[model samples]
Structure formats: C-alpha cells, structure tokens
Target chain A: MARQTHTPSTGKLPGVEKCPTGIRGLDEITDGGLPRGRPTLVCGGAGSGKTLLAMEFIVRGIRDYGEPGVFVAFEETADELSRNVSSLGFDLDKLVRRRQLAVDHIRVERSEMEETGEYDLEGLFIRLGTMIDQIGAQRIAIDTVEVLFAGLLNEAILRAELRRLLRWLKDKGVTTIITGEQGEKTLTRHGLEEYVSDCVIFLDHRIVNQIATRRLRVVKYRGSSHGTNEYPTMIDQHGLSVLPISSLGLDYGASTEHVSSGVDRLDAMLGGGGYYRGSSILVSGTAGTGKTSLAAAFIDAACRRGERCLYLVLEEAPAQIIRNMASIGFDLGRWVDKGSLRFHGVRSTLYGLEQHLVTLHKLVSEFHPPTVAVDPITNLMVVGETAEVKSTLTRMIDFLKNQGITALFTSLTEGGGPAEQTEVGVSSLMDTWLLLRNVEMGAERNRLMFILKSRGMAHSNQVREFRLSDQGIQLRDVYVGPSAVLTGAARLVQEARDKAQAVSERESMARRRRELQQEQALTRAQFEALHLKTAALDEELHTLEAEDQTRRVTAAGEQAELARAQGADGNGGLSKKGAKRPADRYARA
Target chain B: MIAKHATSDTELLEEAARKAKHQKYVLRLYVAGMTPRSREALRTVSEICREELAGRCDLEVIDLYKQPTLAHREQIVAVPTLIKKLPLPLRRFIGSMVDKEKLLVGLDLIPRTP
Candidate 1:
C-alpha cells in the first residue's frame, strides 16, 4: 500500500516528463499530470463526462498553466462543445477568440459522403497542424476519435490513418488527450487507441443508493507511478475536479493557533479559546438542538476576527437562516453584508455528490475563506450513499485542512442516541466531535451538549445546557444533581425548586437562632430572682442570731452583776465565775 | 385537371428521375484477413455485383485485419458480413454469399427483374 501511494516526481524519470493537468485532483493522482508529449486515452461510457473531461483538460491547460491548447472534437461541434463547457465556467469561446485555444469540430456524416480508394488522414493532419501552429498549442484533445470509424467506410484505411495521426500528434511534442467510448469487453469501443496512448484513464458513472457518483481511475500509466484507486470526480461551474479520497498520506502540518467558538463559555468548554485552527469540528445533534447555532457561532467568531467565512446552507435559505439566527442575536446578515461571510444555499437533491463537491470546491476557492461551515451535512446523505458521503466529507476536510481553513460541520441525527443517529460515521475523522442531545427527563426536552471527543487538546467532559436566547447561543451551567445532567424546562424547574428549598431552610435557621436567644434571656431573669430571695433569708437569719446573742449576753451580764455584788464579800468567787462563763462561751462557739 | 398536373408537374418528374438514378446498389462487404471465409465472401459479393447489377452497383470490400477502425466503425461483430448501405432501408447479411437467392432477396434484386 505504501509503495502504491508513493508518487515520485516524473521529471526525475529518464525520458518522461509530466505536464500538470491543472485539474483539481487529476494532477495529484497522475503524480503531476499526464505524461508530457504523450497521448493519454480517456475512455468511458456514453454521458460519462469523457468529452467534458477532455475539453476541460484543454481549457485548463490554457487557462491555468498558460499552455496553449488545440481541441480536435470528432463527436461534437465546436460551438456545441463551447456551449457545453460554458456551464463549467470555462469560457471556451473567449479562449478561442483570444487565439489561445483552437477547437476544430470534425464532421463525419457517413451518409453524406462517398468513400474513395487510397486516401490517408492528410486533410485532418493539415488542419491539426494549422491549428496547432496558429496557437502554438502545448496541449491537444481528440474527443471521441472513434467517430472516424462511423464516417469513414474503410476500416483498413481508418486504422492506418489513426495510427499515423497519433504518431503525428506525438511528433508535434504536444501533450494530448484522446477520448473513446467504452466497449462491451474492450477498454474502448475501438481498442487500438489504448495501445497507442501512453496513459489510460477510465471514467465511470454509477448509481449507488439511488445517488449518482462519477469516478475516475488510472488504468495504466506507462513509466511514472500513480494512484490506481477510483477517485470520485465532479463537473460543475469550475470544470472537473477529482476527489482522491484515500490518497492523502498524513503529511499535513498542524496549526497551534486556536479559533474561538464565539460563545465564550463554549470556548472555555473546548479547554482552549476554541477549536484549533484548521481542525475539522463536528457538531452532531437532533433536530432543533442548536447544532446550527453552534456552527453559526463558530462562523460568527471567525467573521468577527476579520476572517472570511463560507457557509454552505443545505437545509435553509439565507434569509431564513438570517432571520432564525437573528432571534438569537447572531446577526449573520451583517457579516454577509460586510463581505466577511458568504452563504451558498443549494437543495441537496439538486445535483449528484460529484457535482456538489465540484461546486463546493469552486466556491471555496473563489471565496478564499479562512473558515467554512456546512450546516446539516447530514442532508448530503439524501443525494449520496453513506460511504460516498463519508468519503466526500473526508476529502473535503482534508482539502480544507491543507488550506489551513477552519471547518465546522453540523449534522442532524434522528431521534435516537447520538451514536445511533450518526449519519455517515465521520466523527472518527474529525479533530473534535460535539454531540448535542435533547435530554428528555420530564414533560419538557432540554438541550444538552456533550464534547464526545477532542483530539490533541484538553476539552471539558461536563455536559452543558445549550441555550438559544435573545442574546444568541449561550452555554449555560449544567443542572447536575442526583439525577445527573438536567436541561431546558426541567432544569429550570429543578433549579427553581432547589432555590426555594434553600430559602426556606435559611429562614427556618434564622428563626431557630432567635428562639434560642429568647430562651437564654428568660433563664437569666429567673436566676437573678432566686439570688434576691436567698439574700433576704440570710439577712433575717443574721438578725435572729444577733438578737439571740444580745439576749444571752444581757442575761449573763445580770448574773455577773449579782455575782460581782456577792464577790464584794468573796472576790475569788467572782473571778472564778467569769472564768467559767468564758470557758462555757468558748465551748458553745 | 390543372391541379392534378400541378401535383405531377415537370419538377415532380425530375425528382422521380433523380430518385431512379440514385437507385443504384451501394454495398459493403466486411472480411477478416485472407481467411478462406473472407476470400469466399469477397468473391461471392463481387460476382453478385457484377452479374446482377452490373453497371448499376457499387461494392466496397473491407478487410478487418488491414483496417480494424473501419470494421469497428461499421460495427462488424462477425466476419464475412454484407451490408447494403443505400436504396432506402439498410440491411445486413452474415456468411458467404453462397445462397444467392437470399442475397438477392436481401439486396432487392428481384425488384429489378423488370
């Protein structure tokens, strides 16, 4: 696989030089371009864009690479070819008028002519020579060379002339493209052209899942290496663009610069200012879950920073988007009016997957936007198969990242879980995946946004309630409770109930504190009253004791006076009575 | 009477004469290499052109080996095939012209019996 994907420079090869096709994906797969100065055959079934591819190669040769081209159209008229490619934004008429391009439509009506004997393609050679010389053409396209078989009656002469013509084209030293119709068992209706050409590219238009996808593959490249895989191709206003889905070899540079998501909290949720610049961000959600809102926020942030943004509106009109976003204060119209934002709204069912990719590539290049937002990329699944959608998105993301353009894509999932409703399973390719869900907890469904994955960066793991209010998209705090993440009216009700309960609890606590204060004041007054009662009782007891002591003393004093009178006759008896009274008092005390 | 003459006037007769002149047989025979089938087909077709139409037939023989482009252009899936290219409806016949009766019927030579 590594050897197959490796494409060496053709210039380094000995005798082969490659001229860049100047087409989007063809040059990449061709390892620069078609083998220079060699005829490359492009064969396909009818209406498989063979002639268109041939004409585009010539026009691009002249327009992009400054290489003059001569187109020898064998199937369609020059005027018809010019008109056909005009839709691809290739003004072949103008190029012809400028003499940088020459288209010679060969008419081969078998019924109108008579085949004579012994004639070569000298007439054709002369005409081609004159045209090539006139414009000094470096590239030439022979569209449907098999027409010679129909117009000319002699197979022997026609085969001989065709070989000479191919040799002559090679001799002219001009890179050439020869187109042929697909045959039943042969690569081309006329199998000889493939043998004459150096490279063979086959184009296939097939319907898968009812969606048409055109693919191109390099059947054989003579000397140089090329990707042999079938690359999806698209023709639109910008001509042919081949999408090499698996051709990228993981060599793109990563940008460290970050881009804001506009909503500051959402930016914070991404753990950085926003997503990394040039990273692919996926915002997948159910209907009305603010997927578009988040994408718009990213675009709005990009536009605010004076960077250009391209918004591919697949589901809604620009005015509808503007009006819807206006309700959320996004005001995308201003950015559009200022030329910082561009909206390309197309019905998803209008074109096949290839045409859409081509038009998208053209628009992106023309706008040269620094950021691109595809709203509801899931709608593309309606026009393309799941595998095609995945590959197309993968290629587009790769293209955008290579250009250093920050890309944000929003996908709409069904009513199942995020994993169940993944439309194309492109989340694995994304640098960051944001899953939005409608958390249906109660009668109401709330928007819950989850960062499913964010590669190469630290991102928030919390589920945030995404709100689209009059102030635009805001990432509100998640109502994380016993029941987990809650959102919308349920979250609002739960929050309001919690707030009421807190208020009641605080009021009860204050009331309890006041009751305890009142109880303490009552106890202090009771203690003071009891103390006063005790003091009064003590005072009364003291008075009674003093009265009793004074009575005893007076009685003792009268006895002492009698004893003293008697002691006049007997002093010793009086002295003994005082001593005995003193001893009795001491013993009583 | 005048209207009838106007419908079949000199111009109408001239157109009829031109159509008669254009009634010459235009035939093409496809062959692959110098195979016995290819030589036999060429000889039979040439003999038919010479014997049946004589001066009023134009026949061209194409060998697939020499000019595969013309063979493919004519969409010749099989060799030794004959194609009547002119005189109204185009017709094709496979195999050598050994069955002259079928070849005559295919070429509308019986119409020239008069």
Candidate 2:
C-alpha cells in the first residue's frame, strides 16, 4: 500500500509544485494526486476504453488545467484517436502546433519486425523521454503495454527490462502509469507487473446479455490510499470518468418548499402532495397491490405538467410496465415517445450496486429531469452485499437530492398487514408511509389501503377500500372488517360461507309460505261443509211438517172437500212459523 | 442541438477555438487504439494536465481508431494522445505515460504559469 501520505512539501527546485488529477474525488483517494512526473498504466481488454481514457486525461490536463502534455501511441495513429473522441470536442493537431502538446504513435506489428531476445525497449524509452521533456508534461498514460509481452517472448528479460524502465521513470520524479490487458484470471497478463509498479490499477470489462460494464479498481498503490471497492467507469466522448458513489453529498441540493404528487388522493394520504423537490420518497408494498401503477400515475402527472421525468425499471421491462399500467388510466407511453418521460430498464444483479447508482446519477445529471423514480429498490440488494446496497441507496438518494431533483422509489413488501410490514423495514428515509392491506368484511375480502404516517402534514387516517379497475386505483368509501386481513385461504372460505348462507335463507322462507297456505285452505273447506249440513237439516224439518199437514187435509177433504178447500184458500196469511222454518234453522247453526 | 456544425476537420477546430472562452480552452484530440506504451503514456499525462490548469481549458477529443498514420505529418509517435499546438512553447505528453511530479514540472501549471 502506498501509505497515503501528504506531499512532503519539500521545497523542490522543480518548475511546478504539484499536478492534480482533474477527476473529482481522485485527488482525495490518491491523498494528493498522481506523482508529478511519471508514466501511469491504464490497461484493459478488448473495447475496454483504454485509449479514450488516456487521451481525456492528457487533453484535459492541457486545456482545462493549463498543463501541457505529450501523448504517445503504438496501436492507433493520432488522427484515429482524434476522430474517436470528436463528440467530446477535443482538438489535438492545434495543441501540437502551438507546442502545448506532443502526440507520438509508435507502431509495433508482428509481420513487420522480428524481436530479438535482448530487446531493451530503447525506442519506447527514447520516444517517451523526448515527448515528456518537450511538452513538460505533468501527467502521462501508457495504454495497453500488454503488447510488449506479446511481441517479445522472453519473460525473464522482459520483466527485468520493465523493472529497470519503471525505476528510471521513478528517478525522473514523475507520476507514471502503465496499462495492460487483464489476464483471464489475473489482474493483468503479466501478473507480476503490479509488484514492479508503484501503483497498480485493474480495469475490467464484463459482458452479460450484451450490456457491457466497464470498471476500475485500485489493486494496490505504493504510496497512497485509494477506494477499495470496484468503481464503475464510463467512457463517452469525455473519456473515462469513474463514479464515486461514497462521496455523494446529501445535504447540498436546492429543494423547493412545495412538491406535488401526481394524484390528489395519493397526495392527500401523503400529508400534502407527496414530497418536496429534491427529496426521495419510497413506496413499498406487496405484489399486485398497484404499487407500480401508482408510481406510473405520478410520472404521468409530472409529464403532463411539463415536469421532466425519468422512470427506471429494475424489476420489469419498460414495455411491460407500460402495458400493465395502461389499463390503470396511465398514458405514459406517449410521453416516453415524446421524450418527456425517460425510461431505463436493467437487471439489478447484472452489475454491482455502486455501478447502478453511478449510472443513475449520470443520467439524472445529463437529463436534469425534474422527477426521477426507481421501481423496486430490492433488486439492487441482489447485486451486492446488504451494507453495500444500503450505502448505494444512501448515495443515490443524496446525489438526487443534491441535484435538487424530485425522486420516488418503490420497494416490495413480503406480506399484506400494514403494521406487520412496518416491523420489517428498509432505510426509513421516506417522508410518507402508505399502508395497503387486504381486509375481510362479512364474507367479502377487500383491499384496504390508508395513510399510516406523514411528516409535517395533516392527513386522513380512515382505512379506505382500495379498488383497481379501468379508471385506476381508487379509494372506496366502505370500511372492511379487521379479519386478519383476508389472505388466500381466508378469502376463499369467506366467499363460500357467504354464498351458502344466502341459499339457506331462501329455502326456509319457501317452506313457511307453503305451510301457511295449507292451513287456510283446510279452514275454508270445513266452514262451507258445516253451513250445507245445517241448511239440509232445516229443509228436512220443513218438508216433514208440510207432509203431515197435507195428509190431514187429504183425510178431511174425503169427508167434506168443499168445506176444507174453502178454509185453506181463505188462510192466505199463512203462519210466521212456516216462513221462518228452514231459514231460522240455518241461522241457529 | 450542437450549433454551426463544421464539416471540414480544419474548420471544426477553428470554430472550436473561436467559440472557446479564454478560460475555457476548447480542444479536439485524435488518437488510436492501445498498442504500445506510447498510447498508455498519453492517457496518463492528459488527466494530470487538466488538473493543474483548472477550468481554463476545454478538450474536444477524437480517436483515430488505431490509424496514427493519418496524423503522421504531426510527427506523432504515441498512439494515445497528441497536443497539436497551443500558446507559446510547444509541448507533448507521450503515450498513456504519466508521472505526477514530472507533469507538474513539465506542464508548468503551478507557480510558473500563474
């Protein structure tokens, strides 16, 4: 280890005091900066960004830092390098003509020359020495020195020669770097190179599913302390820039007094309208509980209001989220196409968490989006150790805040009880907590969600039934019973019991109606029969009386027909007894 | 949108220089792939140069993709980087080769330049 020591400040007779690496945080990691006058190594494999990184280092030194430099290459010509990094906007030939920089290309080919076993690398030394002195270069980079080992077969001599060259460069009292391709398993093909060099840096390239990740790690530094974790490095037109996740400043961003959550109900539940600008809010819930849909609604709201949004999908693909939430009344795919909504999807385990955090910072910085979101932070945990993930989360949140950007993060909860979930927690960095659970009422199970707590704002505490449909997630007004938050089996049982009870009630009502009808019919029949019998008895009695009177009249008519006929005919007002005979008997019964 | 797109290589550099602020030095560099120590040396030196200078510089970079022969007239022996020209004394940082002390003394950014 290069025991990270401050520069001795020995009043040297040199033309300058110290040279700093323009890369942020690099100076601190190296204690001061690279040694003032030595060549440094930066090596990697195919398409590992070695050439680009070295050029940026030198050109930036000259142009931005006012330090002139000399750039030498054996693989590609200076013109090739220039065209490669044109997008970053660097001019090489002009600097050369102005005597501010010197770039030399040393070509080494297998077919062009034969290497003797005693080769001393004299041409490289002379060319390098000449350029260093000519430009008075403060920083130097040697990209892919592995070719030396390939061109020359004598390892013994090569190691000795390389050691001698490094010592000579060291005697020159300059910070130096030598780059070579990493071996299959070792840090570099010539594994012993680290032992020979003052500082050893390992550059890596890992390809999984065609998304490449380039990283840099300080394997060892002879006189300085460096960040130990593997850091993500990006190469664009600006060349190699390492992402320093640990140094993110959380308290340094500009935050607005007011921030709006896209939805009115969600905002109301969150105290006001979600979080302030430059703040991070985490929305955690179980599967299929509208967590993703809720986030999409927020993104849509932001885009509609002309606030820039970046939606990062770590759990699902962008297309999937768009399609799934399309039914929830979200029109974000249109915004994505219009560029107001930026979507980035990546598997969490594919790269290190630090790298993921770095990429997020890079994108946010580049786009300057007003609102940013990460769907499900759990995936980042899959990428590395728990502590690492936590730190990455902290750093990422800090970075977003420092940028004064509004950020939303969603995480997955294992169970459904809001209280139980609270017990199992992540970093409590959220300003609002929304608890969603499944509650049983009678025989029906409902999705009940509500606001548990919100900082700095008054909110409704009523548990509302959460319903999702074509219109999106809506809070229903009905309350649900507190039945252990109906899970799979309980919900099923409740539904069955409800259906069975309805069936039983219907059957009992039908049986009672049948019994009442039968009793009424029997009473009506008995009353009609009794009335007929009484009428029959009264008719019989009247008939017998009439027969007896007729018999007596017939006997008398035989003796005195004239007298009997006269008497009966005269009695027109016949007795009241006869008139009341049958009628009175029926009335009495 | 990048303004006033310059078509010719020479025109691009001229435009860059003209637009560049005195404190912000606009620079364009051409380099090839990593082959020998020269390329690596150039990579190392430029970063050191950027720091000593601070914000007074701007760099526009281009990679020749291992075809250093295009910049042959510039007498480039290193593949990584070449400072074509600058203010007064012409200087060059060869290869990806970088040394901190050498860079401070060599670039003259500290006590001398100021």
Candidate 3:
C-alpha cells in the first residue's frame, strides 16, 4: 500500500495545531504562530536580523508564554548575545540566573582541531540535552548553526549529521528555531537545512534610494497556513516586529455609539453627535487651518467624559500644545492634573519608523487610554520612506483598532488645500475624513470645513466657516447666494446687501398702503352727495301730494254747492253724462 | 679557484651542521574511520617513522571515528593529514602518505636525506 501525503495547498485547515509567537502582528499572519514542536529554519543575509529574531523567539517564549528556552549560540558568545540585546529590554542574564533560561556558547576553533572520525554530532546532542534537562526547556534557538560544521570537509557526513540533529529535536518534542547564513543561490549556506526543517522563514535587508528596509517572508510552513507575502519587519529597542502587509480579513465589529466632536455645531453638521466609537478619524488641512485645534477639541471632549485620553504629538511638545490649546479656551491643564489626559511627544526625526512604533505600542499598553490622538502623523514620513511609512501606519492602525480605542490623526497639506491630497496616503483606512481649507476670498483667509466621507453614516455636504475665538471653536453657516458660497468679510458684505434689499421692500409696501386709503375716502364723499339729492326729490314729492289733496278738498266743497243745484235740475245720469262731455271737450281744446 | 674552494667548504659545513642537528621528530597522523586509504596511510607513515628515524621519532595515530573530541579539539578538517609538531616550522601533508620523498621533504628531512 502506498501512503498518501497530506499537503495543504492554499488555506489553513481548521484545527491545525500551532503555538503563538507572542510578537505583535506575527501571530495574526501565521494564523496562530509556527507549527508546534517542529524545527523552523530562519535564513538571512548579514545584518538582516536573523539572530535577533531567533533570540526574540527564545526570550519571548520564556517571558510571555512561560515556556523555558535554551539558546545555543554557535557564532556569538552568551555574554555577547546578552549585551547586544540588553537595549531591547530583554534581561537575558536575569532569566538565566533564575534558571528559567539557558545560554550555551559552543566554541570551535578551526586551526587547533583535527578530525579522523566517523562522528554524528553526538557530543552536541549530549551538551544540548544537559541544558534542556537543566531548565526543562520547551523551546530552543540555535544562532548560526552553520558555524558548527564550518571546518568539516566531508559533505556526506555533514548532511547526515544535520539531518540527525533536526530529527533529534523533533523527537525531543521541543519547538526549535535555527538561524542560518543565506547562500548565493540557496535559502541557506548548508542548502540541506531547509529540507530538514518543518518551516522556513527568510529575512532580507535592502537599501533602496538611500533608505534601508528590512523585510521578512514565510517561505514554507508544513501542515499549516501562513502569510506568504514579504512583510516589513522592523527591529529597534523593542526587539523585532513584523508588519503583515496583507490585511487580516475584515473581522472587526463597528460601534454605533457616537462621541461628540466637542463642537456642538460641528456635531450637528455631522449626522449626529460625532464619529462612531472605536473608529479612526483623519483631520487633514493646510498650515494654520486649525487642524490641531480640531484635535484638541476631540481630546477635550474625550477628557470631559471622564475617559482617559492619550495625545501623541509628533511635531509639538506637550507644554506647547497645552499653551496653544489654552488660548482657544480648551483648558486641558486641568484634565492633565486630574489624570484624565496624558501627553507624549517625540520628534519625528529622532527615531526610525520601527522604534517609533515600538515606543507607541509601549506607551499605549502602559497608559491604556480609551482615546488616542496623533497630532500631525504626516511628520513621520520624514523618518521613514514612503513604503515604510505606510506599512508602519497600517500596523499601528490595526493595533489601535484591535484595542478598540478611538483614534484621531492630523495631517498637514501643502499649497493645494483639498483634502483629497492626503500626503501620507492613508485616507482609505480612516472611518471619518474631515477636510479643512483656507478659503481666501478677501484680503484675509478664512478657515472652511467639509466632510469628504463618513463611512456608515450620513454627513453634511455644505461647506461651513470654521471659526476660532477666545471662547472656543465654532462652525457657522456660510452665506450661500446666487453666485457662490461666501465666507469671512465677503459673507458679511452679502448679508448687508440682503438686509438693505429687505428694507427697501418694506418701504415700498408702506407707500402702497397709504395710496389705497386716500382712494377709499374720495369714493365715500361721492356716495354722500348722491344721497342728499335723493332726499330733496323725496320731499318735493310729499309736498305736491299734500297740495293736490287740499285742492281736491276745496274743489269738492264748491262742487257740492253746484252739484246740489245741478241735482235739483236733472237726474244722476244727466250729471254724469254732462260732466264727462265737458271734460272730454276741454281735454281736446 | 679560491672562490670554488670556499664554496665547497661552506657546503661541507652546512652538511655537517644538518647532521649534527638530527633531533627526534614528533608526528601526529589524523584519519577518519578505518577506510582503506586511512589504513594504508597509517601503515606507510608508521613504516617510514620506524625505518627512517630508527626509534628517534614519536608518531601518534588518531582515528576520528573513535575519539571525535580529540579530532574536534585539534581542528582537523580533512582526513589523512600528518602533522609534524617538533620541527621549528610546523608542516602538514594531506593524502595517503604513499610518497615517502614528499613526506620527508614536508617533515624538513630534505637536507638529511642520506
């Protein structure tokens, strides 16, 4: 029966066993860390930090994971190794003194020794076994294993001994790290160590454009998944830190809780109180565009909430920041005295990118602040090259995000004040981006604020005038008119013109009302004159009716005497006929 | 003629001086395993030491397989390396030790070839 080999091609199989490296950002890429209880070969050129990495593994294993380690140095003496790494905050001597660690230096001088043997490194095995038993070490670090076989001339014997040693390490059930010198064409000078080890990691130091950068790559990891990309590894006082270039998939949770920007109007301009909790905010602007002022407002708000805040000022001292913020009515000295705010300042040019990152990590772990503000992160570009700066910032942001700390960073722009020109080129990583510009509309320049984008929230699109006064920072609505959005003195002038136009409209309305009143009075006088003429006509009619009645009465009396005479002379018919005939004849005449 | 005579006298004096200073030599032969070449080298070196120096030489043969510590301490890189320790100028010869003349020359026995 043929035995089949289990080899993973692409991704990690669930439940693959591993050991955590305890180094920041390294465990994330390796899923957990190196394969447990297997030998790992680390090959690198001179000054590529292979020895440092190996030593870090041993030291971190003993200090952090409580796994006792043995360091067998072939090229460097134990004392030398300890001295070289004392600055990295590793007390190697103390660990050895406490019996938790062991450092063995194997000295082999080529000019004094002779070999007439069929040997298989049994002597080395015995020595290492004694040390391992002394501390019950679970991890072992061999610095430059190639040095032990430097004087051996037989290739076959050397290869056999190397294979035997690796097998012995595996049988001992100890996780081991072996350092080697990079060969011209092979991963290691011995060329066979890579095959015998379970995992191989390569480190490279390159100088491009007068800038030095150290990078690390995981060449192979048997039976496990690991980040295959070349990650930028930085070594400083804090030892080695590997920045995994590839994003550790989107596994972070977003917070719906909003924190105030400390400026009420600005908060209203943003859809709500402020940015989301545990989000990264970027405030980019030209010089003197009040970028620091905005950052101070954020810090003040965080401190006012009784939350601890850390202000990392890469460009200014803590005293200078406090003094400047005080002039703007943000009395932060009280916060500092109350232990709510802490300030740490470092010149951007004082250290390399890795050292700065290490310092930041150290302070953050010690302070444990809920909110952090990095004033003018753009200044860090001076210490590192473009790629270095980006990788370092990426790792730093990832760390802060994982810690669930609200982060705010300020960047300085040059002539073109648009916020799109993020000089550091990290706009994509920010959750909220606020762009401030110097809107030069009049003889003086006024500060203007615009929200470029706010991920997962609605934000204002109108540009507002950002005002800084003795009271505090304020956001006032700009004068938007037919032509353009006016600000500063231009806004004041536009406002005045609007007021004058309103006054003129009111005066014209009053004049129109007086003319309407005069026209109504003349119409009323004409109506009264017509009423008097109608009353005179009514009186004349009444008087004529009375006269006619009286005439009729008098006539009736005369007629009564004549009628009585007529009646005596003739009958009723003759009176009627005679009266009607005489009347008709008179009417005709 | 006088110059030729002075040359002959100097030659004779040099020979006499070399004969007078014929001290016992201390030699160490280093070999790996018991391979045919290493065995042959051991045999040839011992025979030369017995015949040429006649009990005036001390030859120590070391097999690298048995005692590797000695081999490591001595820093021997190759097999069949014969080290001449006593001579003012230490010399080393690497090979099967079959070339007696070459070995003698390497051991600073050239002037005492008789």
Count steric clashes of candidate 1: 6
Better of 1 and 2 by DockQ: 1
Model 2's i-RMS, to one decimal, reads 11.6
Query: A567 in model 1: Cα distance from truth in Å?
Result: 7.3
Give lDDT tens digits, candidate 3, residues A319-358. Answer: 9999999999999999999998999888877666665666
First chain TM-score, candidate 3: 0.80
Clashing pairs in 1: A88-A237, A155-B67, A155-B70, A156-B66, A156-B67, A328-A472
After superposing candidate 1 on the true structure, give the runs of residues whose Cα lies further than 4 Å from its correct spot: A1-15, A59-69, A78-103, A112-123, A126-137, A244-247, A417-421, A456-458, A478-500, A529-589, B1-114
lDDT of 3 by residue, B3-114 (tens): 9999999999888658635787888887766777678778878887887777788899887656655544554444566777875556656556777776765565665455
* Model 3 ranges with Cα > 4 A deviation: A1-21, A64-67, A111-126, A133-136, A149-160, A190-192, A208-211, A236-238, A244-247, A312-314, A342-370, A374-405, A411-431, A518-589, B1-114
- lDDT, candidate 1, A368-482, per-residue tens: 9989998888888888768878878778878888888889999888875545346878887789899888877778777888888888888999888888899888788888899
**Model 1, C-alpha of A381: deviation from truth (Å):** 1.4
Docking class of 2: incorrect
Backbone clash count, each prediction separately:
6, 172, 17
**DockQ comparisons of all candidates to the true complex:** 0.05, 0.02, 0.09
